[model samples]
Target: MTVMKSVPEAAYGILLRNQCDSALDEAVEQVRNLGYAVLNSGYSDIELQAISDQFDSARERYVDAYGEAKLRSIDEYHSVRSPLTHGGGVFLNLAMNGNLLSVLKKLIPGKFILNQQNCVINPPQENYNQGAWHRDLPYQHFVSTQPIAINALFCVDDFTSENGATFVLPASHKAEAFPSAAYVRKNAVQLEAEAGSFLLLDCMLFHAGGFNRSQSVRRAVNHVYNIPYFKQQINIPNNMQGADLSPEMKEILGFDYMEPASIADYLLTREAKKY
Candidate 1:
């Protein structure tokens, strides 16, 4: 089996420099080399606080609809799916973040679609396991000539080793075959980052969340983006119906680039003059 080479530790220093277009390019190179990169201070403290507040409000609503016990049984912890529907304003801002988008464009050159927006809350508990090791795009073994999917995990709470920080197998994105269970256990490294940091990852990378052994909960918002040809995990356009949105937001949500397939579609395209 072929194994991908890992990036050197020194390359991560590029992310610590001043914010500029060159720095963003360096960060993207780090992602290509290591399968992931951590951007410290990607969001402001105030922005992070707003995200946490929105998460708390959404959690309450989820609990009211689905009992806490039911939620716990579904997964190791609580997670809000398609959070943009509930946390639209704040998450929309995050999706369109200038710096973040710049880095993403490097990975996926042309127009891309927002596939998913999920918020995960890992509460403290003894022997708590987040989930089995898995990929966001599971069961696919072939490597794409270009990136097919990518993830931006925004930390809402400082991720510590004790609080279920994510564990990743460096350079695994380029591997053509999956590693053995023992091999994975032996090589996976814990990723610790502060609140307001962004953990950008190639979706095919092997990773899993660490067990939360702290006194408080760990929170994060996960954004998964993909090539335009693939359908979004959620119908973002339908979800935002009747809501006001900017042209760029509509484009990212896939309103502007719907491919015309049938004669009816061509007629609609002509009527709207989208092409």
Candidate 2:
């Protein structure tokens, strides 16, 4: 892949707003040019504090129920899967935020669905790297005509170089091979942002989390969105069965749309819609 020698000015700390056409355009351009875009102040101070509190409460409960040792045995870092299932109202509201949805709509034209949601907590430790460089998509050495998947990372705490900020190879989304060691050494850049900022990443971009050398912990929530044709990591509709959900929530969760399995079923669906 070809790397941009200079970062686009619009890629740094772009402020996001609901229904702002120019801001949305700039964000899209930056992502296209650099494979990622940073939006500062994605959430308010009150919202960030509430999310942090909720995360703490949830972490305590998880540790109590499963034991800290058990969690660590599963992985080197503390990761909570499907936080939306139990993250309460604050997380639900954040998932459905208008500004976030607007930006996603611009990046992904037509219908999209929530593919995965998880929280990663990287506490200070020696050699604290979580995973090797990888793409969110299961496939490799492939390029899509349009963006098939994207990640929206919400920083629950300030992301700094010492606290394990994400590192990305700019414009690597177009690459058909893994980055060489020398190329990565020269091109990889750390993304540092304040709490409540959003880092929108192209799913194919080669990236990894940096080591946490600081005394403080780093926390982030990753929400991956994909085109509706792809299968979700978790069956959200089945898991959400019997829960009260609004129309918008149902749509975002992919409960309101589906591909027909057969021609007869497709015909039936169209015929039913006519009534």
**Residue range 218-259, candidate 2, lDDT tens digits:** 988888988888887777777777778898788888775566
List, residue by residue over 51-144, the lDDT tens digit for candidate 1: 7888888778867777778877976247777777766588788777787888888888787888888888777784444456777888888777
Off by over 4 Å in 2: 1-21, 257-275
Q: lDDT for model 1, please.
A: 0.80
CA lDDT for candidate 2: 0.80
Clashing pairs in 2: none
lDDT of each: 0.80, 0.80
- Please tell me which predicted candidate would have the highest lDDT against the true structure: 1
Please state the error at residue 67 of candidate 1 in Å: 3.5
| lDDT at residue 106 of model 2 (Cα atoms) | 82
